[model samples]
Every structure is written in C-alpha cells, then in structure tokens.
Target chain A: MSGKVTNGAGEGTGGSAEGLDAAFFARWMRAAADAVDREADRLTELDSAIGDADHGGNMRRGFEAVRSELDEGVPATPGSVLMTAGRKLVSTVGGASGPLYGTLLRRTGKTLGDAEVVTGEELAGALSAGIDAVAQLGGATAGDKTMLDALRPAADALADSGGKDLRAARTAAEKGAEETTPLQARKGRASYLGERSIGHQDPGAASAALLMAALAEAGGDAEGSA
Target chain B: MADTSEGARVGIVLVSHSKQVADAVSSMAAALAGVPDAPVTGAGGLPDGGLGTSEEVITEAARRVDAGAGVALLADLGSAVLTVKTLLAEGDELPDPSRLLDAPLVEGAIGAVVTAAGGGDLAAVAAAAEEAYSYRKV
Candidate 1:
C-alpha cells in the first residue's frame, strides 16, 4: 500500500503513481499472454531440438487459462490479481514450466501483500522474491539455459532501475535470453541432451524474455495513457 | 485428516508424462492389491492429450482420492516431480496430509497403493513408496 512512485522522468519521488494499479497488472498479464500465444510455435520449435517439443503448447495453454480467469473477475489488488493468475497457471499448465512460472508469480504476488497500488520499487522487490522462489523450486540458476537465464537478469535490472524503467529491464532480459543460445543446458529436459543442447536457445528463457517484453510494453501503454 | 475408524486409508496419486502409462500402472497396482476401488489415481498427460503432466489433473486427482488420512504422490520424471513439489509448496487447495515420494514410479505406485489399501497412515504409505527405492530385480 505504501511505496515510492516514479515520475515521467523515471525517477522515484516517494509518491504513488496513478498507473501502478490492479488494472495495469491485468493489462500486463494480458499482454504477456498474447506474447506467449504469438510465439508459441517458435517456443515449441526450440524445445523440439533439446526438449520434448511442448514448451510452446504448454505455455499457451497456461496463459490462456490465466486470461480466462482474469476475464471472470479482476482482483481488487495487484497482488491478488497475480496470485489468482499464478494459481490458475499452476493448476492448468502441465510440465516444469507450470511450477517454475507459477512459483515466480505466486511468490511475487505474496511479496506484494495486500497493497492495492504498488510502486516500481515494491514491484521490483516482489519480482526478485518471485524469481528467487522459481530458482529454489526448480533448483536452477543463471547459466542453466533455463528461464532463469532471462528472469534473473531482468530482476536485477528491474531492481537496479529503481523499478521504474521497464524498458531497461526488458532489454536486459532479452540480452540474457540471447546469451543462452550457446550454453549447454544443465536443468530440465534439455539436460538430457547433454552436448547436443549447446547450440540451441532455451525455450523457457525465450518465453521469459517475451514476458519481460510484455511488461515493458504494458508499462509503456500505461505511461502513454497517463 | 479425517476419521480412520472405518479403516479409511491414505490415497496414492501417480503422476506421469503419459496418460496411458499412468493409467496402466495404477490399474495394475489396483489389480495386484485386490482393492478394485483402491484410492489410486492417475494424473498424467497434458490437457490436450500430449506427453506431459498437468497440475490441474494432479490437483483434481489428489482431491478425488483423498479420503481423510492424506495422499502419496509418485512422479515418473524430473518435471513431473517438480510440478508436484511446486503444487504442494503452494499449500493452497491440496489435501493437507499429501506427500510426494522419491522412488521408482512403477514400484512406488505398487508399494504405496498396497500400503494405503491396508489402512496405512500418510507417513506409512509414503514410507512404503520410498521403500521401493531399494527394490532390485537381481
């Protein structure tokens, strides 16, 4: 409920911003779902090389369920919105992505607490907590050629950006995801491929980057509206 | 936890990437245990019938089979295990006494279901499942 907000210059001024509300969080989820839907095929293709070739489909199904749950009723607070989405994803999506991503959002939402409006600083902190939960649940770290490749960098960037500059966080996530292409996978199904996984981009990392991009896009739209 | 006076036993849920495999294993375990309606549930396959494990399916199966004591979950692969662990970590709608076993899927399912049918408690059933880890064909 209480956190510093950023002004148009992307500087924190210790006040609440109008755009950081449940509605904005809802838009962010929708945008991320759309991104997943748009890129599901590509994600699946990436998985085919080193995984079971189902990442795209799994993500698409998970986000679609999230979309439906959001449609039913938007929660009163940003934290609840994310918690609801996270639970829906955990119950609906199959495979490792479900648990990893679900933990990310659920832990983030829990960190957000009952705040109706959250500042970038609070959101960044919550996201860091969420990312940490994901890492703990999957036993994955950066350089594992997993979603953490993108998510860890994005969290660091978001925290460093003072939780206001979504674009900077998105860029960092994209770069991190790209950096995974040449690394050998050490976690999840891709690990089974061993040396063969060296040249492939990780599907989970790719999807994580897309989700960051969606966050950036949603932030931009909120700023534009404001 | 519910009343076990009527011999209500812990349930077992098998999580696998393939629906066919989960079904076959659970059915075989049920037949072997001679408990036709044994609390052995299969939570496998993607929603679209693809080769993956669904959290929804697992959650539903856990709810369906939980008679009171608790549920024991056995997963076939890494992701399946991770999914169940994540589900339990949430501590949301899942049955309170449930646990995930770190044992071989086929053998664990058999051991856990038989124990549950024999009115084993949650810990005992979970122990039965984990005991399958020492199973050797030799």
Candidate 2:
C-alpha cells in the first residue's frame, strides 16, 4: 500500500502510503508477546548469570500485563495502543526492565501521538524515541552491552532507510542484536559483572532484537491477512 | 461497561526494586497528561523482606485512586506480588484480580493505565495490560 517518495524527501516527515497501520502494529505486539512467552526462561537464565535472576520472571509478569491490557479491546490508533502498553509496563513490571522497556514504548507512542495513520517519518521518530528512552532509562551508552547496543543501530537504520518496509528494518535490527556480543559491558545489570557480561550476548539486547523480529513478522502477517 | 466520564480511569502505582526504577517509569507518565498525573507511583523494596506486607502497600496505594476509577498494582517480586495479591483479595472490592497478574510490565502497564485514564473500561484496560506482553522478546 506504500509508494516511494516522489515528493520532497529531505525532511523525512512526509506520510507514507505504506507505513505500518493499526493491524500491523497489533501483529507486531503479538509477535513480541509470543517471543517473551517463549523465551521467558532463557531471559531469566541470563539474568541469573550476571544480573538479578528475575529477568525472566520480571519480563513474564510484564508481558502478561500487556496481554491483559490489550485483550480489553484493540485500540483505535497505533500510538494509543503502544502508549497503553508502555504505561502498563511502568506500573506493573517492577524492575529496571519495567522502566527501560516502558520508556521505549511510551516515547515511541508519544511520537506517534494522536495521528490517525503513521507515516514513515513518524514511525522513525517513534522508534528513535523508543531507542533514546531505553538509553536514558538504562544509562547505557553505545558500548554498554545493553539493549541499546542493538536498539540504537536499529533505530538509526530505520531512519536512514526512511522506514521503507519491514524487510530492511528487520535486517538492521538483527544485525544490531548480533553486534552486542563483541562489546564489553559499560552499564546496567550486565555492566555490574564487568568482563563476565562480555562474550555472552545481553539478554535485554537479545530480547530487543526479538522485538524487532516480531515487528517484522507482524508486518508480514498483516500483509498476508490483508 | 464503558464510562463517558473521564474521572473513572484507574490510578497506576509503580513498584520496583529501587526508587530509581520507579522514578524512571513514573517520568514516562509525567510526559503525558491523559494518564493520571502521578499515575505512576513507585515504592522501593527493601532487601531481607523488609518491604512490608502486600496488603499494607496496596491498600495504601489504592487509597490514592478513587473507587470509580479503581487501581492497578504492578510490582517486582517476592512480597511485591504477594502484597498486591493479598490486598486485592482482602480489599473492599477487587479491581479485577486478573488485572493484578500476568499483565505485561513495561508496555502493558503503560497501555492499560493510559487507556483507562482515557475512559476505557476496566476489562479493556486489563486486556491492554496483558497485550503489552506481546512486545517482549522470548
């Protein structure tokens, strides 16, 4: 449903005919939900090794909360849907994950705001907001070996690509996730372990990659259903 | 049940291992006005089981929200969950026990509370909370 930018393209805010819509957003979240449920144990295992052992449980409770919140009914706008999800995390998750992840979605949602349909620029802004929020919340710089290690590049690529389609976004996100392995810990729970946090990919960063994967899958599903 | 009135949204209480986590999440809410001002309220959990009973904390938090709006409680672990559960069971009326558990912490809580504040039903808000879980990485 999206056509390339024939109009002025420099500003990047011009609405895209193919940008993610409500259904696509829902599918993305659904994929995210599934990834969390499937990997809850692994996340906890990672947390147990370096950070607190509750990462799995913490994430489990957080996603379960999101499920309940969304089951109430599909939201009208993408921003509203994401914002609701973000707020619930802040209130219910109860850990660093709560704020970090919550801030990501909340800031992303805020960027989407009350818009009826989100364009590529808006989506890029939202994703960038999410990445920035995570960094601010976790206090992790680029080399910190946290979720930002993955998320920063993902957002950058999305903006650089101009939010063309899910394929490019997914590729960037996965690459970003993979990049975390070589970096040393500089902040967050992983940072506390110093060198131990290195070599082993950060659970949060891994999960962040999973979220992007889900987003790609969701977009595919939405297209398939359509 | 849907309420046309705006005052019926639930109040959100944030619980975390440290005050920093709570404050960080609360700051997100502060950025938006539709969700209750201070809808994100946080309490620090003391190690060595010093955080007090679940009932005590939830009841106190519940008091901040009106009966019409109700309240949703999200916590870290140990006594935090138990305390919210305890308060839900013993409180004058439960805000919907389902809302207490399995809801997504990050995306779920934010979505639920923001939606509720926007005049969404308890059932709807609760579902949104649960749906937030979908954003997680497995």
Candidate 3:
C-alpha cells in the first residue's frame, strides 16, 4: 500500500482497465477485507471519539464475512460475486454504516447485472449508484463531515476524468478523502460533535478511500493481465 | 445462495437498544427488499437491558421473529445472547431464530433479508447472518 496520496485527474500512476471477471472482483474484495481487518481497531478508535466505537469492528466483521462467503464458493460472474458480497455485508453489519455501505456495494453490483466482464465506464456507473444510494440514505451532502464527502467527489471525478481509468479514479478518491480533515461535520455522530469534529477525520471516509485505493491496485494487476 | 423463495420463509427480527434502531433497520431492510409490501419486520429492546434482564429482551425479540418466517433473533449485547438462548429452549410461543446467533445487526440483518429475498433459504440467510458477525470493525 502506497502511504503517499496522489491528487487530480492526471494522477494515473496505476494501471488501466483490463477485463475484470468474478475471480478478479473476488480478489479485490478480499484485499479490501484485509485492509479493513488490518485497520479495524484504528477505525473504531477514531469512531470512539465522535461516533460509535463499533464502526471499525462492524466493517471488519462484515468484510470478513464477505471473504468467507466468497471463499466458500462464489458465483460465476463478477457482478454476482459483488452482489453476493454486498448481500453478506447487509446481514452481518448492525449499524447505520452497515446498510449504507452494504447498499453501495449491492446497488453497484445490481447495475452490473450479470455481466462477465465489466468495463471502466460500467464500474464507474456501479460506484456512482452506490454513492447515490448512500447519499439518499444518510441525507448528507458533499461538504458534510461524512463518508459521502469523500465518496461523492471520487465518483464525480472518476466519471468525468481522463479516460475513465482506474488509477485516475483512485487518485481522485484519495484526494477527496484528504480534503475532509479541515471541514466541520454536518452529518452522523460527528455532526453531534460539532466543533470538536473538525480536527478528527471520519473513519468511514477513511475506509471509503481505502476501498478505492485497494481497487486501484487490484485493477492494476488486471490491467497487466490484459 | 440457497433458495428460500418457494414456500420457505425466514423472518427478520431487528434487535436494537431502542425502537429507533429497530425502526431504522426494518425500514432499510424493506427498502432493500424492493417490494412495497414485503414484510421485513423488527423488534427493539428499548431501554436496552445491556447485561441485565437478558431473558426478557430475548423473549420479546424471539416473539417478533416468530411472527414471520420462523424468526431469526439478533441482539446488541452478550447477555442478549444468553437471554435468547434460554428462550429457544423454554419459550413455546413460536419457532426460534435464535440459532442464527449474535450478529452485528445492520449488515447482518440486511444481508439476511437481501439474500433471503434473492431466493436464499433460511439456513443460508442464517449462515450469512453468522458470517456477517465477522464483518465487525475489528
């Protein structure tokens, strides 16, 4: 994992899109689960300050469940693997974030339908759907101190940027995530924290960035194969 | 995904510390179900017992689950787990969903309902819910 963050549309340092299938997506999810597991305690610690301390633990459990479900024998299509994983998240997580994040994946997977191979543009649409769903549920806008702050911009940049490349999208997501530090939270438990929420970063937002970053790495591998 | 679409029914019983949590989870589950009339119901332990009165909380939660497809009980604390376990062995009002075990709530409930709605069986949904327990923040 590159601890260094990148910015703007030109930051396509990672690989581009290749054919993405079920196995590739499963691997992406696996990496994401691993990242979440590794940092679950950190996320929970962050949340412990402003939100429920369980956010990290909840996400870690949900993603781990997804990993188990996939390892047990996933479906044939890329979309199905994601759809199944999304469904699994919904069942295991028991907080506001669970449904919100789970819906993101489930909705995105649904957009892909049963496609065996997903294009860069299609993946963008799926991610957009996930972001939109989260926005609708949380009622949080782009500037709000919530995960949407990171997600909305990332989706927009990914959609409008140079060539719809995976690396470009990931860079956009990381930059968007960093931009959250200076703002006061207007939604979620952070919102209740008011002025105190300004200095601390939102854990959900951080994990959201992690998801995009890991996807970028995994997609790079796929690009190499293609 | 196991098929539970056919006469097979698996109910969702939301167990939160407050009615607000239960309502919110049920609402989310209904939305995920995508069917206007789909009944993804919930039960709350408002003024949550936490560690005390586990049996009472579990009984209520189990009753709610029993109302639907042979209830799947989900709770917030360890005692809630103990309470539900006792209810399974002693309560006679309805079929128990307690065996699904203690889960995260939001993700677990949603995953169970979504998978169940997508034709996965009660066993599969329960297993998915159990798997969801691992989705914890860490």
Candidate 4:
C-alpha cells in the first residue's frame, strides 16, 4: 500500500467518450472497497491524530457492504448501483461522513435518472449535483478542510475537461487531500479540536481521494487490478 | 373533554446514538415536564444495539408519538444529527411537520417536553427546544 491514494497508473485513462454503465459503477465501488481496505490503517492513524479514529473502520465496513451488495446481481442501472451503495453507506457507516457521502451518491444517482448508461456530459452534471448536495448536507465548502477539499477540485478537474482526463481528476483529488494537512478544522468532529487540528490530515479527504482513485481505475483510465 | 384555552401540542422525538441515553433523556424530559404522558418518543441507537442513529429508527419513533399536531426532533451528536437531518431533508419519510431541533439532547428534550406539555404549538415547541441552545446554567 502506498498509504496514499493517487494517480498510481497514469497511462490507462478511461477515454473521454466512455459510456458509464451499471457494471462500471459496480466495479468502481469494488475498487473503492479494495483501496479502502488497503489504506484503512493509514486512515485510522490519521484520524487518531485529530479525529475519532473510526473513519477507516467505518468506511471499510460501508464499502465492504457496497462490494457484496453489487455482487448480488449488480443493480439494473448505473444509478441504482450508486443508490444502493449510498444507502448502504448511510445505514452501516454511522457518522457524519456516511450521511454526507450517502447523500452525495444518492443525489448524484438520482440526478442521473434511469439512464442505462450515461455519456460523460450527463455524468458530469450528475456528479456536480451530487457534490453540491453533499456540500449542502455537510454545510461546508472547498476550504473547510473536509472531504470537499478533495472532492470539489476533483469534480472540477473532470468537469473542466468535459469529463475526460480521469488521471487529472485523480491527481487533483490527491493534491487536494494532501493540501488539507495544514488547514484548521472547520467541519465535522475535527472542527471541535480548534487550533489543534491544523497539523493532521483530514481522514474524510483521504478517503475521498481513494474514491477518486477507484473512479479513475473503474473508468478505464488507470491500470492495476484491485 | 378539552379546554379551548389549551392550544394544540406538538410531539417530541429524541434521537441519540445510545439506546439507554435516548430513553433516559426522554424519560427525564417527561418527568421534568411534570406531565405523566407527554407526547415524547425516544428513537435511539440502531435496531441492532449499535451506538449509531438511523433513519428507520427515527421515522418509527416519530410515527409512534405523532398526534397530527406536529413533531419536534432532537438528535444527540454526530450520526444522530446527520441521520435526523437526512430524514428531514428527505421531506417525505418523517411526519408532515417535523422539525429537527438544533439543541443539546437533555436540555432541548426538557424544554421541548415542557413546552408541549403546556400545550404549545409546533412552532412554539420547536422554538422552546431550540432556545435551550443558549440556555444559561451558570
């Protein structure tokens, strides 16, 4: 494990014209589960510095549930796959991040409608909507030292490129996660630490970066199997 | 059987991560209200006894206490707050006029229960509960 979820594979970027389907979303979730499993210890260690130290475990359980869920006949549409995953995260994770991330995926999947497979343009819009929903749900923005710090930039990176360049999105997410190391806590439980939260990285952001890394891999933009 | 001077009272739902804490807080609030049967329900912990709140638990509790007036929802910390908020934002799962109170569990529950026991309306009950956010004990 690199202890960092970044653009580890730069060559196999999922092409711009890729049509994301249910299978693709299922694979993305599986990849996310695997990455989270690999990085759980590091995530817990970071959380211990300034958080409740359950981010890693909570995320592992949530994503592991997602993996098994998708394995059980992979929902009919891409939106359903994400919706299932989102529901699982909310029910099993039991924290701020779970609801936040759950709303993100649910809203995003909802915005995608019943499309069997969606073009990048539609996905871009849905992704942004999902991200916006998360922001509203958490009441935090890009600089709040939360997962949005990573998620917003990555979403922007993809949207700006017209939904191409998963590598760029992955890199942007990694960098955003890295940049949170020095920010004071402004949201979630970490915010309660006040000034003491400045040095530790945000576990939510780190997990979000792993999410993007998984997205890139499932999008066919990256290589290396989980 | 009811006096016209007594206004419509709202129901109160207390949500907490721990089942015991939720039940204790609700009971304490009811007792503090000096009302034997305040319309308050405690929706705490997952159905599986885990220390986390869930939408299902909250929804069921709200349904149990709802008397068609309204319901004031108070959640204690972290997932409890998130779970309640998520239900509120859904705008469909909870009762028609449910409001998620932004107040401490014990304090808010007492305030809300007292207000409801006194025949306060939904808005009044919610305001009273929220007022506990600034309630001074010093």
lDDT per residue for candidate 1 within A65-90, as digits (tens), equals 99999999899888998998888777
How does residue A11 of candidate 4 score in lDDT? 37
Q: Which candidate ranks first by lDDT, i.e. highest?
A: 1
Which rank order by TM-score, best down to worst?
1, 4, 3, 2
lDDT of 4 by residue, A100-211 (tens): 8889888889998998877666766888899999988778888889999999898898888777666667888899999999999898888999999998889999999999
Give per-residue CA lDDT, model 3, range A106-214, as digits (tens): 7788888898866666777888987887676566788897788777766776677532555565666667767877888887667877888887778778888767766
- What DockQ, between 0 and 1, does each candidate earn? 0.72, 0.04, 0.05, 0.55
Residues B1-138, candidate 1: write the lDDT tens digits.
Answer: 234647777888999989889989999999988977888988888766778778778888899998877888999986788889987887876798778888899998898899888788887777888998787789
Point to the candidate with the largest DockQ.
1
lDDT of 2 by residue, B53-128 (tens): 2233344555665445656666665435544543343334344432463564556557766766666766766777
lDDT measured at residue A119 in model 3 versus the true structure, 0 to 100: 62
In candidate 4, what are the lDDT values of residues B15-54, reduced to their tens digit?
9988899999988999899989988989988788777777
* Winner on TM-score (1 vs 3): 1
Please count the clashing residue pairs in each candidate, in the order shown: 0, 59, 30, 4
Q: Give stretches of model 4 more than 4 Å off.
A: A1-18, A222-226, B1-9
Superposition error at B122 for model 4 (Å):
2.1
Model 4: docking quality category:
medium
Candidate 2: C-alpha lDDT? 0.62
**Whole-model lDDT, candidate 1?**
0.83
